[model samples]
Target: MDFVPLWAVVIDYILGVVMWTLIGRFGMGLFLPENTSFFFMRFFVQATDPLIRLFRPITPGFLDARFVPLFVAWFFYMARFYLMPWLLGYSVMGMLSFPLEGEIARGLANILYKFQN
Candidate 1:
């Protein structure tokens, strides 16, 4: 269904927030040994760096650089909570009614309505 992709995006955003929160609360040291260049860390760094870079400039430096991840998480949550539903609603309205479209739209509308509370 059309809303499936939008739901996936919402899930990804939630995962991103959780990932950032954990990393921000506990620095990489807890997860990786010092001086260890594990493949997972490399992968995580690659996945998160662009987002950190985007937010770094706007973030206040009252705390350590660790806050970057939390800021990114908050940004993702805001986008998910405020922007995603509206975008999905517009997208659904634009599409032709396939057999599954009504069901998908109803599901998405329900999700958005629930989140609004």
Candidate 2:
């Protein structure tokens, strides 16, 4: 019997998307300057700008501006790793506690497996 609630799954999935997007912005920032006209970089910047702003108070002032996305992503990661299970009445974190990332990794692994065969 599954004990996890549907609402928890949905919230986790949404937070997962935000966390991944923040990390993506950090990765892409390595290759593109903030003011560059590249479409993907622009999209990432626009999408995560609000989140960055929201987390600004907690963000460390010593971090290079380029690293803020990664810092914000870490906050999300911690929330999912610790807070999610606590909210769901679990005493410990499960392997699949992060549903969206687990599903994505499984899908990618399956695709790689098929390609290898």
* TM, every model: 0.49, 0.87
Once model 1 is optimally superposed onto the true structure by TM-score, how far is the C-alpha of residue 113 displaced, in angstroms?
A: 29
lDDT of 1 by residue, 1-117 (tens): 444475645564455555554364436645664345776666556667776777778878885564566666766655545455555565444232222334567899999999999
Model 2 steric clash pairs: none
What is the per-residue lDDT of model 2 for residues 24-114, given as tens digits with 9 covering 90 to 100?
9999998899888999889999999999999999998999999999999998898888888888878676533688877788899999999
Worst 10 residues of 2 by lDDT: 88-97
Instruction: Give RMSD (Å) of candidate 2 vs. truth.
Output: 2.0
What lDDT does each candidate get? 0.58, 0.88
Give the Å error, residue 48, model 1: 1.6
Q: Which stretches of candidate 1 lie over 4 Å from their true place?
A: 1-30, 33-35, 89-117
Off by over 4 Å in 2: 94-96
